[model samples]
Target: MTQPQDPQRSWPRFQTRKPRILLLTSQFFLLGEIRAACERLGVEHVLLDLQAKEMGLDDFVRTILGALTTFRPDFVLTVNHLGVDREGVLLQILEALDLPLASWFVDNPHLILPAYPRTHADKTLLFTWDADNIEPLRDMGYPNAEWLPLGTDVHRFAPGASGRPDWDADVSFVGNSMVAKVLGRYKAAAPGDELAAKIREIADAFGPADEPSAARFMLGRFPELRDAFLELESPARMLAFETLLTWQSTLDYRLDCVKRLLPFRPMIVGDKGWKDLLAEEENWRLHPEVSYYDELPGLYPRSKVNFNCTSLQMKGAVNQRVFDVPACGAFLITDRRRQMDRLFEPGSEVVTYADPEQIPELVERYLADPAARKAVAEAAQKRVLAEHTYDHRLEALMRTMRLTFEPAAQS
Candidate 1:
């Protein structure tokens, strides 16, 4: 193994044009933001949109090798887990090239089953709910891993820009419920085939529902409900009980998840499972209403209080809306996480609810003190723009990879 050298004295300085950067991501949906960030940094970027490419292993490696030869980028960035299974090809070629590679992963890499590989890049940037996971990456050999929170693109997801009217209700949310079951029927006939068919049916019907997709669907189905859902009618207390009920799952677990739903107006959004779980309850607005990304920024701000609850596996990891909604200038009351304060100034910039029961009063208090809520949102936005953006994180990556790009004198 190559021994680690002292950190670079200073980053390479280029004249006229910015650094030539190559970003290889198979996820096409992320291409726009990656390109935008590169543009903002004045970096000349060649995006190998893996979604658009159609090539075999040999062809893929050859193409990447050729791109490296022609582009001669100072840096190459990729999502930690390539959507394409054929990642070995890309990694082998990039490693051979001695390129300054940076991996940006959005999820809590620590708990993901069959963990995303970490061999190719110099640094792995990840987001987490509990900030403590930073150490494990180093323990696992990714000494360069850093905690970078997910950032919402302020340009698109803003409340004022959504063109939707101000919502009338007190609190609202706009994100999908995640599937978090690992299956535990060791004795009773498994229901394996039934489960598979049900999943297949939903996949076929909804076409792989994501937050943006769900938001768009809602906008199309109930345009007027946008405001009502965005500014939901507040429940009896400050906190609302919310859950993404995996409809087909048994009531025991779903109800356990639901116990926290009603107190805060428990606005559940996602698939038909949530509806079935609620079974025509007066508090639950079952089907997803706010579907598009562009609409989220405005939608979150309309509510006096917005609750963000993550699925079990992701409970310790901060969701995109943790930053997105608040960055949109909304006061968010989120489930407690240890890492939250490290990312945002607690009490001042963001607020966390330790118990579901606390939400209602917290909401009432924050709403009553409009100026304090606005102050908190403003501070959170400032912090997000400064430290949590893709550009900011990219700059951090550049710093981490400075050793790779530094000149002999700087080294």
Candidate 2:
């Protein structure tokens, strides 16, 4: 591969004009949505034409250098730190070019950020969808970490057309079953009985708590995991254990929540793992996963109550469904999250359950009361249009980035 050397690239210039953005391309759905938002806001931008995975420094530098010459972005943006190599090659290249990288972490930053051994506080800006993550990220060596919660693409997810007959239900939940996720990680780690027990204990404890991390929880509650974890014998294995347990915990929590919905015969759309989770039960309808762009928007409106259960990895963060379903003008009955109060007014704009036990009753109430459901759904749609669209988020991010970084550029 030919490499570009000593490239003369323009640094971040947060000037009077709308700052041009160089959107890092990835396999993620968010990247496409961000591109649409950029177009909606009439922001000048370019998507780097390159796959981020398994990329070497030479190819990365060359591609970014090629884009910089043309796009000349004030900042390079990507979600969940896409295009960022674990070895820090991308960070080093960007830092050398004096280009600031704004990474929005939609997933758990704890699981993702630790893999980056090389990062610069000044050259990188971290935004998290979880408000609870802001302080923790600041503690994790990123001083300028900001809260940027996920928002719906109002134009795409808004209420309009009728959904497919097959997709219609009293309640619907669109998400991965986490069955394969937990199993794959379990097989990869192959922990011994003692370590596996440690995992089980941590996961059981982790699933119910407000804390997002079992590792952080273990420091205070369980001491024996340290010795048991040493048996794994590699940092990769340890990280695998962390990931495995998190998924396992989520699967445990989700399975329980979904089981409660079995009485309602909820239409579940996601990976085939759901069949495995609901193998014995014949009540619920499970469909293969649908595309976010093609089907989910239509599917959300068909359900009187769109069920939501957050992942254990996200302790306080509201999942995408909290925004998507409501934005579609579909009523939602979600498990209560700590940040629900800020984004939504539970019991009115959106319905929330404090526990799994409360789910069935909430579902029954909302499903029975069509007028209440419509009112709540309409209220939620209004709120989403006014505040939680990608338009609002991108505009806010543009203003915040300029206010936060423009002075630094001039300095």
Candidate 3:
């Protein structure tokens, strides 16, 4: 296959003899993605369901040793959390094992630092491009650390024919605005400012701002944004409701940062806690969240353009939607990220807005020019399928480990 430029020095190639994979994850949520990737690569994979069994530190270590003995995996893949206490048992096992290992750090690595082996692991995969993480990995003596953005299963999020004569607006967003606690973590106003700028840009693009700039903008050009925000009594009510529902869905503050942002859409499928939250919102057009791998490819195509917004921690990283939506050959309009241009050509493969303000106009432009939208989506789908598929990732990982062991094999 083609070599991945820069992020990692080269792509990992697949081997005829599938590598045995041992996946250790604290959350049950990821068990699906891990299984799918392994199945596609034909790798022998064993998943230790820590959440289901309520497995913790010492138990996890004993389990890893047992798996290594039984499965004889060539590599280990751990989720963000490594171990429970100091001199973590998992960390110890990794140090002793001759096999290579790596982690997909989907969470903020800084918050969970010190759980990782300071001087072990062949490589570490990051979700965002944070320069700060590099120094720590270097200090810890890891051989390699690089950003591998989060992705969605394209087959699961595929497009459906989402045309309904009675749909509310030409464009819509299923998300909330909760800024307080987000600021507490990053101490940055990018999220708030970006949201406001998106609104303003849409207004200016449509027409001159009047006394009620939002209302005037909506009344004239983007009636959708005005409709979405104005439906709530006030901004405070919107913010309060968002924070409250999020608390119900995610018991911990950590989960709230990511899970809470999802808009109150009837179609979103998640935990039972999520169903309870949706039940409270009578207006949402709720549907069961899909379970199978093939369902996603059917879902994303239903909308003209899907909306993606980022949390404070994920500002630098494109969410899974960035990859998944395009992979389905569905048109996507996403928030701006500095590195986005390098991955997919801007206004070509994917459409990006300078801020939320530009969303309406951008959406309008895409709707008006179906040819352009179709061309971009098709191009993106082709590019992502060629370079960014999970199989591509599996190949890259295997190739690296093979190279790491090549010298040893010769000796």
Candidate 4:
């Protein structure tokens, strides 16, 4: 079995010319950022839009093959195996052709990647946004798994972009309230009343801890529930249960945070699910979901402070908002994640709250001191421009590919 090259060794200039990359485009938000990075780095790329639901599986595979032959791309890239068929035909085809496949996972890979059969192809490289996931992925027999944190497209999400007055607010949050959707599915697929009760009990016991620890606590408290959960026998059923638990945790945290900031009348921008959560709260304004490209860039800059409450799905990792909000030159107050300390200087570049109780004090402090807020926002924006742009991420990705596979290909 092959291993990646030593980090100390100087990487060879693996590409003599601009490498043609075949981008398997999907509905994922990061697709545009990836494409932008390719363009910025002068990589010739073609997009085979896999998000077109109209295309059948056979047609999708044929179209990919057709694009590959016509474009003669040096590598194929996709977000979380979006273009790959359930039968693993795409991996088989790529393996037969000896073409390299790169799949970057921005979401929880464990929940989705396992569902995609045949992920162990030798020519495939798996990139995850979380450092915690690297070991698990490697444990799953993927030797090429690597840690590649998410990046923001600075060009798109930059400061001074024209923003509407109506969009401006003191504190703003942009995300969905996944409670209804997740719980609805969980209830529909629940095995039995006894099992459902046990699950609820576990959820109630779950605190502000990481997923792995919470899982252990649940199993420790009621060992029988572990077998009951496992006995469901359907991966989808397991996924639904896990997802509901995470969302329920998030729903509780988000509501608590927003309720604390209700006096300030923080703006909530996302889905109608929030309406169900905050039906009587007229002080807190709710807006329809904004487009990432069109609205978020402008809105971030306009708001004094952007509150980033990460989904419960991500434990150690910060969400896209952490990078995007700062790139837009906005002050952000986010919940502290273990990984955030490495990403930004807390209190200087980015502000954070350890718990809901601390949120109101932090918000009040920042809201009262405009100079301090501006200074921090500017510092964060500078940091993002210098280090956290998509171009930097893509360059690192290319370097990894070159180091790992280029030497073997050349030999």
The prediction achieving the highest lDDT against the true structure is 2
Candidate with top TM-score is 2
lDDT order, best first, reads: 2, 4, 1, 3
Show pairs that collide, candidate 4.
none
Give the per-residue lDDT of model 1 (tens digit) for 198-316. 43333233322332122233445546535543443332110111111122222332344344556556545455555544665666565355655655655676677776665433334
Candidate 2: residue pairs that collide: none
- The sequence of per-residue lDDT tens digits that candidate 3 reaches over residues 1-411 is 211123222222223366677777667555577688788778788886556455555565666666666766666776675422235455555545545566666655554554333544443433234433455555556657665555555555545534333333333333333333323322322224333345325423432221212233334564444445445554344443233222222223222322332332323333344444344554334344453354545556665666665543433556566788787777777777766876788867888875555655666677788788789889988778777766666666666555555444436
TM-score of 1: 0.70
State the weakest 10-residue window (summed lDDT) of model 2. 3-12
User: Candidate 3: where are CA atoms >4 Å away?
Assistant: 1-18, 52-59, 82-87, 114-136, 139-143, 160-169, 174-299, 405-411
TM-score, every prediction: 0.70, 0.94, 0.62, 0.89
Encode model 2's per-residue lDDT on 278-371: one tens digit a residue.
Answer: 8899998878888888788899888888899999888888989899988888888888888888887777898888889998888888888999
**RMSD, candidate 3, Å:** 13.4
Give the Å shift of residue 219 in candidate 1.
Answer: 44
Better of 1 and 4 by lDDT: 4
Q: After superposition, how far is residue 380 of candidate 2 from its true place, in Å?
A: 0.2
Candidate 4 segments whose C-alpha is farther than 4 A from its true place: 1-18, 54-58, 204-207, 212-221, 280-282, 408-411
Specify the poorest-scoring 10-residue window by lDDT in model 3. 1-10
